[model samples]
Target: MLKFDHVSKVYKGGKKAVNDLNLEFNKGEFIVFIGPSGCGKTTTMKMINRLIEPSEGTIYINNEDIMKKDPVKLRREIGYVIQQIGLFPHMTIQENISLVLKLLKWPEEKRKARAKELLSLVDMTPDYLDRYPHELSGGQQQRIGVLRALAADQPLILMDEPFGALDPITRDSLQDEFKKLQKKLGKTIVFVTHDMDEALKLADKIVILRGGQLVQCGTPDEILREPANEFVEEFIGKERLVQAKPNITTVEQIMNPRPITIMSGQSLTEAITLMKQHRVDSLLVVDENHVLEGYIDVETIDQNRKKARLVGDVILPDTFAVEKNALVRDTIRQILKKGMKYVPVTDENNRLVGIVTRTSLVDIVYDSIWGDEAAAE
Candidate 1:
């Protein structure tokens, strides 16, 4: 939906912000521009909405040169989000969100409805509508900022480090939520961030830059498997390559299949017997269809052994079940951080498919850095 044809941006002092960039952003795709400080990620993004004008070359949206369009009219047709959120403190949440719609002369009822609909998309409710920016938390305020961008329903959206200011947990949560929202809405988004993990997690295509030049542009898997050069490899970090491998490695690739399990209806005695036979401290508890319910461990059994006759009575909620298609490195990092012994691997339907343990992670690391033969040895 957007194209950059030999685009270059040089400041008045002759510092190049972007150097002969040639790229295309497809419709309904989440494209991320990521790099270190002074890498021109923000510059390239700003040029999309004319916040920064290009020094040379043409930018096209659906084959029409953007230079031909008036800046105000062009901006109104495209959504722009920034790191600061830029919400008006005096305005209510509803008014903040509906500002763009109101500018476009949308009916009052329509604007109000859009605000409510957008809030609902982010799991916020009508109760938040009358509240001011200060009334909400940082994360909530950022959500409102995103809602404001989507309120006008523009086909093309440009986000410049939209989640950069939030804490790590909130940033990750927002990234996941925004990714889902993008897929559902099918809007073409050009997102900028310096964080490589964010790009790996959220981008359909990643464009890596350095020194105001394009370093590599490809799918996360493609870049992970084969970086364009030493600079690209270094930027991705050797540790990230070993641990998370981005889109290239998945839990399914290393997970142990046919993990020992106990049915929810199983007796505590049976659960104890199973654990002893398997020499495991815990056994995954599953329904008849093998859907993961939770788990029962020796500790839980010992605590409730006399009080609980059934395993279900002592079953502890499953806290960590890695998705089968999740990146092995990312999954391993989470598991190790939480000090978990193992994690169940579940399919899209939440059916238990396999398991991953520290031992399995060792095998994966060995196989990743070395060869299968070396791992076997």
Candidate 2:
């Protein structure tokens, strides 16, 4: 556990990074520090590991004052990953991954095994161990840097925008992977990012900083549902209120469940008719259990009418869809990417529970942003 008791940091020119901050991080808790650039998020993280000592106030790790501890020893016990990766070009991937283990004088055989295991954990092939840092892609190299930090088996991990440089798709995959790894290892993690979306997706708790001060600290749902102040709410944007969150929300909140269905044995014409009649873009094809077979789009029906095929011939299976409880934010993100107006939401039984159209999703987001006025209305 870590605690910041009235911590404050001022630079040589009297610039304050953090002001009278009081915070507590429970054991094995993953906390994210997020805000605009220069808001002292990184300053707070570095103070924990002693990369930058506070100008005033006390920082405690395990209830003991951190300032009294040896900086080098403290850093050795903390895993750190920065945005630039900073891997040594002369070192092979294996060496990079095992840097800490080697420094700790791990046995040659053990270091090799640890490096191999970690490389595989980060999705690097076994053959990659022999290659140098420059041989890998930016994303792969970033993974290596992160794996390197964890190689030492540290109790705390500090990550500052670790995935900021990667493409959106790669960043998303890495975020999911990090979540899995964290769940397995359960380290006390302090992550810093400017991205609200990333903070929401990965953080167990979010710490929002503004103008060198703590604004709010709470779980993702807590912060999203009840922002602490006008600044916090405005910073996160009122738009997130109705922002569709299908990943954790329900179809009933944003679905047109009664407007769409597909017959087990009907021509494309019937499917098209059903969609047009209901004013929906797609129809759900179901089996005896009301289990969803797939989705039949209006375009699919129209293009294949000459073949006398049933809805099953062109239904998009669950493989191409997401759960009904998926965050509507992510759902709308994907829809916007394809410039589509609809997404299917299914239940655990794989039944076509309901359909979420763009209009519905928009309404949710709109409501989230403007709910204050709506309540008054």
Candidate 3:
């Protein structure tokens, strides 16, 4: 429940970091600010907590102007997280997490309870309560930082790249955990990150900025499906644009559901016949359980037809395979690099699901970028 009216921030050197930004963050919605470096996304968020004052205009929280309120009192009502994971070295994990609660004059027992509760939310055991900041790993420390912000159950939270420092796997896991926590709590959150994928995944609404100016604001799907202009399109990047296209985000979305397959012990003649009937050059080879074993092409079959009677004798182990849930952009890159006509798609258990062909990818891209023009013609 925050609103910005004609907000602009100009520094001492007459440089504007934010230009006439007018926005409203709805209650219980996750809003993300995204753009390149020097785009003032951080500046925009900082202004909310009064860490950075705006040069002009007003910021309001629940119909009250923030500037008119005491900065310290205003900030106490809001939760804040930054990239640095700023935990005091001298404070124990429990103390650090309960810092905000303590400041609010919460009693010792309640603060301790809040600390334990927050730790459990992040999957940390209560034993961590006695540990210091240095005792935890980087990811653990960041988790504590997030917990600290939520320690007092503030109605609004501001996070500025809170997971940027962690490894990809850890960051991804935290993102999921944070999303769940946000939904469970229903707190209004303003998040700022340069990563488009993170914004697309997390934000209910995405606000794009460039050179300190509002470029576009909309839902992730809306922006992806229809960028405001060339700058907006380029900012979203080609890979994400592809992901935003209708029914083309993942390998499973484009994979041939019933790709021709032959059992391991099938005869070479049968493999050739299956290939001919399917009008394809290659056939996937599988075990009785339909688990992918390898593949055999017409050339391989022809070369070994005389000596190898069974398809298994000629099938070459599949070198390139992608999970069905993987991004289509990654599958496209592998296909292009390996000069493959199609790549095998497998389930999480490695059972063959289907195949993703180059043709499928090209068709999706074409329709996304130029399908409207072709339709007009």
**How well does candidate 2 score on lDDT at residue 303?**
79
Error of 3 at 127 (Å): 0.8
**Against the unseen true structure, what C-alpha lDDT does each candidate score?**
0.89, 0.82, 0.89
By lDDT, highest first, what's the ranking? 3, 1, 2
Number of clashing pairs per prediction, in order: 1, 20, 0
State the lDDT at 4 in candidate 2. 92
TM-score for each model: 0.92, 0.84, 0.73
Model 1: CA > 4 A from native: 243-248, 336-339, 372-377
Instruction: Report the C-alpha lDDT of model 2 over 1-377, residue by residue, as the tens digit.
Output: 88999999999998998999999989888899999999999999999888899999998888888889988878888899999999999988888888888877889899999999988787778899999988888888888988998998898899989999998878878887988888888888999999887888888999999988989999988888788898887777755644623233644566777646776667777877777787777777888777777667777667777874777777777534557777766666667755766766678877777777777866776665675578789
lDDT of 3 by residue, 346-376 (tens): 9988899988887787777787778867879
Model 3: residues >4 Å from true position, as ranges? 247-252, 256-377
What ranking of all candidate models by TM-score puts the best one first?
Answer: 1, 2, 3
For residue 197, give model 3's deviation from the true position in Å.
1.5
Q: Residue 99 lDDT in model 1?
A: 95
Q: Tell me the tens digit of each residue's lDDT in model 1 across 55-140.
A: 99999998989989999999998988899989999999999999999999999999998899899999998999999999898899
